[model samples]
Target: MATSRIRERSPKRDSLDDLELPEDYVPYVPLAKRRAQKYQKLIHKKAGLDFGSNYEDGSGSGYDSNDNYRRKNKDQNDSGRDADEDDDEDKQPLTGPQAGISLIEQSVELRKAQLSAEEQKTDVQKAMEEEAKILAAVAERKQLASAEEISKGIVYKDPIKTTWTPPRHIRAMSEEELAATRLKYHIDADGEDMPPVIKAFRDMKFPKPVLDYLKNKGIKMPTPIQMQGLPVALSGRDMIGIAFTGSGKTLSFTLPLVMRALEEETKMPLAKGEGPIGMIVCPSRELARQTYEGFVGIADMLHKGGFAQLKVLLCMGGINMQEQASVFHGGLHIVVATPGRLQDMLNKKKFNLDLCTYMCMDEADRMLDMGFEEEVRTILSYFKHQRQTILYSATMPKKIQDFARSALVKPVTVNVGRAGAANLDVIQEVEYVKQEAKIVYLLECLQKTPPPVLIFAENKNDVDDIQEYLLLKGVETVAIHGSKTQEEREYAINAFKSYQKDVLVATDVASKGLDFAEIHHVILFDMPKEIEDYVHRIGRTGRSGKTGIATTFINMNSSEQILLDLKHLLKEAKQKVPPVLEALEDPMEKYREMGAAGGCGYCGGLGHRVTECPKLEQQQKTKNSGMSRPSERAGNEM
Candidate 1:
C-alpha cells in the first residue's frame, strides 16, 4: 500500500501539449567548477610612494573635508594627547616594520644557494666515486700482481695417469659384508641368483672387448641394479625393472640392450623404414640424449675385435625434424628418442619398427603420467610381436601394470627398495608452512646448504617468481620449465651443472631426465599434485650413493594426504619423520579412543545413536519451556 501511494503521488506526463520546446533561445551550458583555491591577499605598495606615510593619521587645514570631521573629535581627545608626544610623532613620520626585499631577488638568492649545495653534493659524490674506483683499481692491481707472482712461481703438471690396482691384498666381502651391502642398497631380487654377483666383469664372461671397455670406464663391479637386472633383461625375456632414480637404472637397461644388440647380426644398409636394431624411448630430451650417449660410448668400446660400430640416433623435436628424420633415413644401429617425437615420426611413416628387435622405455611411469600412453601404444602397434620389450620405471602404477600385461610376455618384476620410493641416500624432510611463508622458508633452506640447489615449484610461473625473488634477495638463480625454449632450458641446466649457477628453480620438467652430480639439496617449494611427482622431484638429489638433503614446504591443510602418505613412505624407508606429520596421522583414532559407542549417523551427533541422541538435550529444554508457556490454556480447557 505504501509503494502504491508513492507511485500514485509521483508525477506522470498525461499530454504532450504542456511540454516545453525551444523556440528562439540558445541553451546555455554550465561551466565546469574551478579547482584552483583562493589564497590570502598579498599587500602591494604603490610605486614611488612611501610605505610609512600610507598608514599615517595627519593634521590638515580647515579647508580639507577630512580635517573638518577630525576637528569635532580632536578637542574631546585633547586631554589625553601630550604636546611633546604630538611633536615627536609629527617629526617621526610613523615608522613601522622594515619590509623585506623583492621576492625575485630572494628567489634568485635561494636558487643560487640550492645550486651551490647541489654542486657541492655532486662534487663530493663524484670525488667519492673516483676514490672508490681508484681504491678498487689499486686493490685489483695488487691482486693481479700477486696473481702474476704466484703464476710465475707455479709449475704446470700433466694430468696424473693412474693405473688400476686390483685389491689383490684385499679380500672379498664376507657373508656379513655382503648382507650389509645388500641391506644398504635394499636390493630385492627374485631370480635363482644365477649370473651370481661377480667381483670382476671378466668373471661375467662378457666379450673380451666389452670387458676391456668396462675396465677402461672404471667399472670394476656392477651396481646392485646392474647386478640383479642384467640377468633378467639379458635372458631374452620381457622384464620390469623398478629402481630408484640415478641408482644406475640407465646402465641396467643400456648394458642389456647393448649386449643383445651385439649378439644379433648387423643388417647392412638397414631398410628405408627399418632403423636401429634397438630403440630406447625416454620421457624427455635430456634423458634421450643421455641414453644415446651411453649407447654410443658402449658401441665405441665394442667396435674393436670384429664387433661392428653402433650408430645411434637421438630423436627429439626441439631441433630440426629434418635432422632427426635424416638419421632414420640412413642406417642406424640404435635409436634413442622421446615418446612424443617418436610417435610423430611413426605417424609420418618416417621409420619402421619391424627391425627394432630390442625396445626399452626408460622412465615409463613418467612417460605415461605425461599423457603419452596413447602415443606409446601407437608406437608399439608398429612393432612385431617377436621383439623383446622391457619397461623401466621408478614407480609402477595400475596403468603401468595394465600396459605391461598387454605389452610384455610373462615378465620378471625386479624391484629395488619400494616402487615410488625415493633414494635411501636422500634425507627427506618436510615442514608444515603457510603459502605466504614458503619463499622465506625456501630462502632459509637454501642458506642451510651450499651452492647447486635444485628447487622444485608446482608450475612455470611459480618457478620464475621464486627465481626472481631470490635474485632480488642477492642470490643468483636460474630456472627451467617447459615454457622456456630448448636452448634456454639447456643453458639453465648446463649452468646449474657447471656450478656457474648456484641455485636452480624449476618445474617438474627437470625432475626426471637431467641429473646433476653435485646437487647437494632438493627443495620442493610447493607440494606436487601427485604422490609420484613427489618421488621424482626429490629424487634429483642423493644420487649414486652420495648422501643429499631434500626439503619440502607443505601447508598443513593442503598437504594432509601428501604428508600422511609421505610419512608412511618415509617411515617405511627408515627416514626421519617430522612431528607435524606424526600429529596429523589418523585423526579418526582420537574419536575411537573417546569410547563413543555408535555415534549418530543421521545428524552426525556424537556419543549416542540417532534414536536416543544426547544432542537432543537443547531441544528438550525448548520443549519443556513451550509446555510451561501453555499452562494457562490447559487450565482454561480443564
Candidate 2:
C-alpha cells in the first residue's frame, strides 16, 4: 500500500531554492528587533551628510562602504572622496543647542552620577527600605482595624513584631533573684524553693493604674497564688500555678494580661482578630464567657484610668459564628475562647496571633482531659513568641507538667496546697449505698441540707433524671448539661444563681471554671473517675474563705483505689471518715501490693460478679449452719 511514495525515483524541481514565495508571506521579526540591513542601506539618494572626528577614525562610528581610503571619504555612498576635507572640519568643535532641561534638574543628574560612597547605597538596600515602608503602611491599616474591632466587643490581633519597645519596668534579674521572689510566694521549681512572696500588689511593683483597680476591687492583699504568679508573669517568665479553685487564681493571670496589653498598645499597630496581645483559652463555653467577663471588668477599670483602651471577646460554641467572627472585626484586644471555636477561626484565616505576647490557659489540665491538646498546640504555634505563657489549674497532674515543659518556658510553679489535693476547707463525707438506693440517699441529703445545693451526676441522662426526681420530691430544681442549648444552659445557671431554684443538677460541663457563688453543698451521685475531677468537684463548695460540705455516694462498683485515696484524703483534712469506708478491709496483702484486681474476692471464682458467683449461695448456707468450713480458715490464713 505504501509502494508508490517509496519507489518513486523521478524527482520534481520542488527544492527550497525553487519554491515560489507566497503572495502575503512576510519575514518573521522578533519583538523590538531592529534590522541592521535597513539601517546600513542609504535611504537618501541625494547626499550622505558627514559628522567629522567627533567620531574618530576606525572608532567604529563612521559609515563603512565598499571602499576604504584611510582618513578619506571612503564610503562609496559618500557624495565625494576627500581625506582632509572631513577632518579639517571635525577639529573645530561644533557647539549645538540642547533640550530645555532646567539647570536644577541637570545638576541633580550630575550629582547622582558623581555620588560619594557615603551617599550612595546598593539596590538591595534601597529595595529593603521600600519594602519596610510598605510593611509599615500595612501595619498601620491593621492597627486601625483592630482599634475599631475593640469598640464592638471583638478582639483583634496585630503584626507580631510591632515597632513598640518591650516593657522594661521589670528590672533584669538572675534566677537567684527570681528564686527569692518564688520562695516568698512558696513557689516550687524542680525541688528548689523560690524567694519570698510579695504581701501586697504594690510590693510586686504593679503600675499605679493596676494598683488602683485592685484597691477598687477591694483586693488589698494578694492571695498565695497571686502573690507568686503575678511577679513571675510581670517578669515575662512563663508561670505554672497549681492552686485550689476560688483561690483568686483568675486574678493572678488576668492582671498580668491587662498590664502587658496596656503596655503593648503604646507600641504597635493591631488588627481585628489578628494579634490580640493577650489570649485566654478555656475548655468550655461557660468558662470562656466567665473569663471574658472577668477580663472586661479589669479592662474597664484600666480603661477608666486611661491606662489602655482594652476590649475583651468571648469565643464559644452554640453562638452565631458570624457574630463571633464579626466581633473580631471590630477591635478585640483580649480573647477568651474555647478550643474548637478559636481553632475554627484560626483555620479560616479570620484571626491571627502574630503579636500575642501573653497567653494563659485556665483549667489547662481539664483541656487536655477533654482531648484538646492538639488544638491548644496549634494555637500556640500561631504565637511568634509565647512571652509569658501561664497555666492555671485546680490540679497539675504529671501529664500537665509534661505538657508544661513543652508549652511553657522556665515556669515557676506555685502550689497553693498539696498538689492535686482536695480543698482542706470542704468537709467531705462518703456514704455506702447500692445504685438502687442512690435516689433515697440523695433525698435524705436534700431534707437535711439548706438551699443552693449543687448535685453532680456522671452524664446528661443522670442529670435529667435527678433533676426530675428532685422536682417530684417537692424540691425546686434546675438542670444543665452538655446537650442543652447555650441559652437554655444560661437560663438554668441564672435560675440557680438567683435562688429561684433550690437545687441545680449538672454533668461535668458545670464542674470547671464556672463560679457558682455560695454553693452550700456539692453532692456527687456518682463519683468522678479521675482524682482531679474529684478535687474540682469538692472545690465547688468551701470557696472564698467559707466552709461547705461535699458528700459522695460510694458502692462496691467504685474503683477500690479511689475509695482508699478518698479515705486517706478525708483523714488528712481532719474530716470524719465514715464507718462504711473503715469497715471495708483490704482483700489481701497480695492484691494490695501487686495492684491487681484479682478474681472475685467473694466467691473465689475466676470470671464472675461478686453477687452472681456460684460459690456465694454455698458460703451463705455454710454461714447459716454456724459451722466454719475448713476452706474459710484457709482463706483467712491466706
**Top-scoring candidate (TM-score):** 2
Candidate 1 lDDT, 1-638, residue by residue in tens:
99999999977889965767555322321222110100000122223332221111222221243545344334323533332343444344222222224558768989999888778764435444454454343222111111333345532222111121223322254646645555665666543322233334554446787777777755677777776576556665566788887777887778767765565535354545555678888877666766787777788888865787666777886767665555555566677888667877777777677677678888876665454555666676676435667788777653354446445555667777667767888888878789888887777898878988999987667888999999999887999777677778778877887888889998776787566777889999987745667888888888877888999887754545455556667776688878877776453344355543322332222222333322234334544665321221111111
Model 2, span 561-605: residue lDDT tens = 556556656765788988877765644334435454433333122
Clash count per candidate: 1, 33
Model 1 lDDT-worst window of ten: 33-42
Off by over 4 Å in 1: 1-186, 190-200, 207-218, 265-273, 303-307, 324-330, 587-638
Error of 2 at 262 (Å): 1.1
For lDDT, the strongest prediction is 2
lDDT of prediction 2: 0.65
TM-score of 2: 0.62
What lDDT score goes with residue 218 in model 1?
59
